[model samples]
Target chain A: MGTRQRIVVAGGSLAGHSAVTELVGLVPEAEIVWVTGEPHKTYSKPALSKEFMQARNELAELTLPDVAGDRPRGLRILRGRSCVSLDASGRAVTLDDGERIDFDQLLVATGAAARMPGMLRGVDGVFPLRTLDDAVAIRARLADRPKVAVVGGGLIGCELAASVRAFGLDVTIVERLDTLLDRPFGGALGSYFLDLHRANGVELVMGAMVERVALEEGRVAGVHLADGTEIAAGLVLVGAGSEPCTQWLDGSGLQVGDGVLCDAHLATSSPGIFAAGDVARWTNPIYGLRMRVEHWTNASAQGRAAARNMVALATGRQDLRKAFADVPYFWSDQYGQKIQMVGWHEGHDRVELDRSGDVPGPLARFYRNGRLIAAAGVNAPRVVMRLRRQIEDEARAAEAA
Target chain B: MKIIVDRQRCDGNGVCMGIAPEVFDVDDDLYLHVAETIPEDPELRARVRQSITSCPILALKLVEE
Candidate 1:
């Protein structure tokens, strides 16, 4: 081969780490440098709200084992350092310390960061549950045994409330939505969500806005709702949501939308540049829709797919590059219940909900224009997974047609 | 390669089953069942290894012979 290609991978989380693992196997002669601003790189993020927060998983157990592959000989890792900027045309990456890394190809898997409101910032006993460190800090606060208030009723918020309640502590959820995850099934599962959380002893304030956090001694003492309801909480956790880490690509001449805008092939606007993970909002070929999935499974699979395409480009084998198409799947564990959804549930005109006695749990199938597009099941694995495959076949058939 | 699953930590998330369904399967009871014998296929073997590590809970461990 010609002089070995140099690849710079930004972000050391799941997406970036998974990409490096595959690149090492595909191009052993390539010099790869991975950069991240966090120290506990490669930890399982899903556990942060579940097992880790519940104390079922130890800190050491959160570390992920190296995926089945040989270690890269031409690889270097820079921890606690982040890539602050990128020059897409020049193929240069600037680290936080002002160090510049030149490369032939660049993978922008920088991932996402927590989206916290300004009102919740700089307050003691207020934590955003996004990273391992966030989980650690929350867990340490659990020793004090304070009343908890969770902001948001989305996946992370509900999951966090469930975990905190597992300790038999008092926790309340303040959600702006009328029901939790209404977009998932258009409020079909609203009662089910309320039932599960209420039975688990969680206080839910739906259709409520947080006016402010009442603090005592600069620490959270209570939360004030806009409707004039006050929630007394000693510790407050915000599961609001996350924003993609794309500020570094600002003015870098790369197309940036809610995330790095990519085509179906996961290629960015610039040549020799690609992006994956939560930081990528690409056209999903499976649904013919543009989406950015910030879940564990999508990041893992996208990382591998992007790396494969990057290798095909680096080797000048344009024909070998393949478009990344996937049926997004995510599962949440709350109060010992396994809730899973596979496929996109957006813009479905019709929903076929099955709560029959035959099924293990409530199942809902979403269809757009008479074509099956998504499925969701609670505590049902085999049937749901079967529907997952059926969804792939049907969605792909529809996509082809 | 022999696979060992820590039952306590395994919540049967089916991440492994999603990757290589031929080697791993999760039933409706939220139980993960691994195949008794792994087929002698290189591509399948690599995917099996990925399935092991891809397990979000790190419940699966591989013991090589």
Candidate 2:
């Protein structure tokens, strides 16, 4: 056999971990070096909000099954090491400790970091739920179900509120937008969620910007809004959003926008280096648009696609390369209801309630320029499934046209 | 192939039903059930396997009959 090539993967989250697994399966003889900033192995980040808060498993149940288990002979994981710089010209990376490692192929799946508001930057009890450690820290700070104030009414914020409320704690959700989940689900579903949270005893503070975090003895006492209203709370969680983890590649000369811009094949600006997951902003050929998705399903699919492309490039079989395109799918659990969405609904001109027949929730469909673009449903799983297939079919027809 | 679902692990996310409607169904009560105990054909068997793997919670599993 010829000399094996070394493949270095940065960020041991779902995306990087999935890439390493795919690489091992695709090219068994390749030498794999996995670099992760965290100490533990890959775990289900989605489970952090859904499971970690309600029950105190300490993240034992959230770990991804066998991601860091037995290796495939040439696989080595460098845990607790972060990539500080990338030398694209030299095809290498400098770790936080200044150790430079050369690679035949590099996959940057650094994922994203939780976005914290400027006012609450150094405030204690202001937690962002992104990693296992974040979840653990938040849980440790919650003592005896103190009043919990969650900033941002997005998916993570709502889910976290729902999970913590299940512990019989008084929870409040503060959102800057007029309605919750309006960007993706639109007004109808957003109002529905507003009602759901209210019905479940969750206080909603909408259309108000948080001015600053109230501090008492160097800890979070509550949040003060711009309108001079203050909500008292013992703990605060800021789930505003997430930004791509690409600051380490500042001078790498790669096309960095909201994320690392990549082609349809998940290849970055630099050759032999690819990106996947939330950090990868690629133009999806299927949707005929560019988007950077933070969904778990997208991360898994992109990770596998990036790994296959890397293997093809290394084996000198460029002809066998495939484009990365999958319909985006995500699910959030809140208030005993399962919210599922398939396809992109942004910029849709019309949204219609397709079904509301006492199925506990409604199924909504979004259309753009007379073309079905997306669909979302609450507790109507089968309808959402059928709509996803329809969206896939429509996307294929559009691609063909 | 025989289909099995771990009810404790299944959160009724509907991922399985979305992948294979013939084999899995999530009711309005947010409960997952096997619509078809056995896949009628080879194509359906493939889809059931896909559903099993697509389940985010890893609640669904396939067993050889």
Candidate 3:
């Protein structure tokens, strides 16, 4: 064995892609194996529901530029293959095809899958826009100009609803929650989101549960809500939510909750194993809370941080490992308006609303014990982003204190 | 290094500004303003490259001289 050091990275999305690129640069002497389940190169998933769904971006345009500046000599990329199981003690991962690859260190960034209700499972016109294939299928259906019924008014559902409305198709959003983006915005921008959708000619069905997906001739015909209403939608788009892809690590002796549980350093229970992206629920030092962020920035930043730590552990340079600290941030583009949110707002108590034109748009700041914890705004990139930096500074000061 | 932005595709998320504020700034009008010349600092330049790649809309492009 020529200086045996091997690192295994699973998943092909942004997190895994970023991790592999960093590892390639950091561990020039170690063997790196990347198990990318998707055959295509890494692309931006956020564009799927917006640009790609609206056909504003071509299929080839969504591909992310390669970040692996200088490819390592011992790097191997296994495309179109997935991890089936893992043996933590044995330090090996079994592929879907029963091949076992031993690793000195492992990084799990499998991401998440869109949740589909059982009633919508076999319906032909039902779609979920989590993956590229799903977006392609939904785009194909959109060419038919079918009445769209969007399930859940979360980020994906709201964005897709706006995109579908842009096509002049009748769109009805069925959300169990009363408001749009309540969790992310922390109910601070209460009626702003709702009014935006309404102003865009989107049909909002609030506090309604999708009881079933009406089918005709093995295809989605409409949507049935628990409120005793039947919406005549030719096709149904389910943006219900997502579940982290952790079924493969079921018996791997790793702590797996809603996601792969890890520490602030993103290290899993196993010494050489770590997790990041939507598949990781780790303790965030900023808020002192365990969070599983599906946001793109968290995945991108955490992937790079976890890769450095993994290299340190694999090379026996443990002192070089550092804790990953980040104030989560994400933005949404809907009907020509930009919605941005920064910092964690789960436990915020007081919220201050600012529509006095101090900012470029309607903005709200969340607070706990008079500390700025989170802020959300519409079309206010400069002010909102500045608040993000302030939140990071406050967090740093608090940590030092 | 020179920075170019695709204004047509830029939604002005300010992700680049969050990474390297010295080189990227978005105004109140949600217009992204890139620095005319990026200083030749190795660490800052690396971050600028990361910021370019991190743009949610992929609107930023870097040209090295």
Task: Looking at model 1, give its docking quality level.
Answer: high
Interface CA RMSD, all predictions? 0.8, 2.0, 1.3
Docking outcome class, model 2: acceptable
DockQ of each: 0.81, 0.49, 0.69
Candidate 3 per-residue lDDT, tens place, A66-135, comes to: 6565355878889899999999999999999999999888999999999988988878888888999999
Put down candidate 2 lDDT per residue, A320-381, tens digits, no spaces: 48998777889898877889888888878998885547555777888988888888888777
Winner on DockQ (1 vs 2): 1
TM-scores for all candidates: the values are 0.97, 0.92, 0.97
Relative to the real complex, the DockQ score for model 1 comes to 0.81
lDDT per residue (tens digit) for residues A116-220 in model 1: 999998889889988888998999999899999999898889999999999999999999998986664456577788999999999889999998999898789
Which residue pairs in candidate 1 have backbone atoms (N, alpha carbon, C) closer than 3 angstroms, thus clashing?
none
The weakest ten consecutive residues by lDDT in model 2 chain A span A60-69
